[model samples]
Target: MLISTSKSLFSSLIISTRNTSNLFIGKNVRLRNYHNKFPLAGIKVTVLKEPFNSQLIPKLFENFGAEITIFCDTSNIKKQSIDLNLTNSDFVKAEVFGTKVTPKKYIEAGEREIDLSVDGDLNVLKKYAIKSDIFINLENKRFGEIGFNPEEIIKLNPKLIFANISNFNQTNSKFVFVKENMNEEYLELLHQNSKTLFTLGEISCFTKILLTLFNKQNSGKGQILNLSISDSLLHLNRLTSPLLLSIPNAFDRFYLTKDKKVFSLCLPTINDQQKFLKNLNLTNSKEMSAKIAEFDLSELNMFLKGSLCVCIC
Candidate 1:
């Protein structure tokens, strides 16, 4: 199933299979090198969503050698293409030639846009589910609002790894939306908040999905993964800085260097602070800004290396 490395820091090996009945649990099998480079080769993935939403998921799967097929309606595809400035000729080429002749922009937007109407028959989705190893749903709609039944699809393909990304969890009816008729000021606020929420949500879902894939390798079973943007943001906030939860902007801040370059530094503990100050031959943190201003970004980077300071440029 799954083979992980020991704590010695050696390279780890992972082996996966659909049939575990013939697998030897603890016995060592002779290792052989194979020319195949892609870890997810032969894995079939089906994604149900517009091309604009959750583009990274399909790209990630494609990078790992998984065959990804995205199903969405024609209007959404046209809107996305228009928004991204993709020409009809290029879109047609991408559709006809697939990845072989796909432009970088088309790939970035999402590859091979299949037109499957959301109002279409459930049997169409079922056809894909029966052969797919992984199914990802990035539609903004609630589970009930989604045209097909997830349970029925899973029953058709027991080994399918189903993942759903929503604005909120299934139980919560509250949806994220701003009507076109809304005032500009109110719409702007909604847009900004939604952007931030979705960004954090995508990060959380990406991590959880990777972990779920690993779990499936170990257990040889499939499970449903439900991720909400708001919930993910809360979870991330808790894990990142629990003590500074009440204090706004308590985390690291960026500074402009003498050469106008930007960087962020963190000296969390007393020892780190002492080490940083000692390296700079300074007595207090009060001189940090002035001292940092004296050096160029490159010089500052070199100075922070062994001073127990975490610096990002």
Candidate 2:
């Protein structure tokens, strides 16, 4: 789930970003948070193409009345039109203000290759970006085409808050790349909580931008933030790792009462196991498990109710 911020912060913007793979699929990111805060009502923003995290940057800026200008290839525009179920013109109007000048026609004039990593590409984009307060680059696919160093682009306009989305943390030392990863090995811990994969990077990067946008820091200049999916999962797992290790053979058990399945790190003591066997009139571990499997749904529900299993650490 996408963590929420303040309501006053979201009201000014039309939230369009969402987490497509998690619970409540396709839910907008803005409907969740509300704390007393400032809004970006008048800031100007320019975004290049749409990436996985594309919905968030614009929504956050919109919360503060920020005027957004999105520049994407014609193919991307058509795809968005189909995805959002809106006409091309209608979609354009929904993203930008009426009075703001858009380079739609200018961009469509030629098949221009805009790569922010390249000095020439950066210069071309700068023409449209010079007038904006922030620049967000979501074109991770074209990141390899970056020719000039990121430091030079920051020198072009130090005041601007630039956010670039890339899986690798090598975009530039000046710009933070939130890394989102998807791996099969994490399935063990991931299945334990129905947790989605590689979403931590998106959440971390979004939080970083919010911190800077609220003037919580001196300036976003020269700051680089990396939020990788694996890194985020590691950070999250650290909280309960010690307690999990405290128990012997904690990873070996997968709780099963018939078809209903649950997991427990609770390793019953020898004394407790003996008592359970005697109470159930069972002689062996296999017999004990068979008795448990025969329990009715309601019986099982009451037996396992409450905090019978808690890690003190």
Candidate 3:
């Protein structure tokens, strides 16, 4: 599950009781919460790395038949345009904030027009308002320690670092996924043998093969796969592989992971696995056409990739 806001985590917990409610924590997509009270099914949501052209609430409610609330870290000052846009839908507002002294007292502040929060990522929740049932979170990195800039990366981590999230309780997003419940395999073998690595490819085959390896191994016991998986199908190959970015003049961070053995996921088009894995990392050098068609290509999109894809430089 890809719970976007740290603030909306609890109410998500209160609404239902299903193991599918596990939040997307970093690249691992590991399941940390086993005691959820929410019925975790039939809820699949994805957005926020990019914005939709229309209001998502009415559409989600129309499509999903539930209150499609949007919880965002408040990112802008003229949040009213967002508010005006939301007025037509079933969208309401809420906030996700953290107090200075305690990680124990995470609170959700709700206001009809504008949800409130002290930690100040209210806009993070708002970003989902377009096609969601609810709206939550208000932000500015200055307001809280964490918020995103025009760039999609997390801006700051003063109050909550990546490590802090492991300790913090947040709601898991609605996902069609299974939990990587802690097992002796990952635990016993994790004594430094696991390594994290990333690759960027204009050549999709390398990335495709890598993701397949991770999924087959359940995200690998020790290695981490950081992929800059792009939706650009026309360019079927990563004109440049991940290592190309290290050249100093390059731009854009590639997908990344902290663990060495576990592979971070990267599959294209969230849906239609066949189309996503079409090329499956193959190519003819001269004509740039796929030459080696050996692997079984039917199971392309059957395996849904993780909610988390960490980019590294």
> What is the alpha-carbon RMSD of candidate 2 to the true structure?
16.5
Each candidate's clash count: 0, 16, 79
lDDT of each: 0.53, 0.44, 0.25
For residues 1-313, write the lDDT of model 1, one tens digit per residue: 1112111111233544433468686763322221145555566888776433446556766765667887653333333323345454444444433432322353324444444454443456668877777888776554456456778777866767888776554432122221111211221223233444445557667667767766665676677888765466555544665542432221123344575343445444566567666766898766666676677777766766765443221
Ordered list by lDDT, greatest first = 1, 2, 3
Model 2 is weakest, by summed lDDT over 10 consecutive residues, at 174-183
Q: For candidate 3, what is the lDDT?
A: 0.25
- Count clashing pairs, candidate 3: 79
So what's the TM-score on candidate 1?
0.50
Candidate 3 residue 309 C-alpha distance from true site, Å: 32
lDDT (10s digit) by residue, model 3, range 1-313: 2222211333343323244456444662323222233222223232221111112222322242232333322222223324333321122112111111211112223222223344334454334332221111212112134433322222221111110101011232111111221122222322221112111211232333223322333423222122221322112323424433222111121211222122223322223223333344422222111221232222221333442222222
In angstroms, the error of model 2 at 286 is 32
lDDT of 2 by residue, 130-236 (tens): 55556665554432354424445557655566666544544222112122221122222232432332344455666666665555223334333333333433344
Index of the highest-TM-score prediction = 1
Compute each candidate's TM-score over C-alphas. 0.50, 0.41, 0.20
Query: Which residue pairs show collisions in model 1?
Result: none
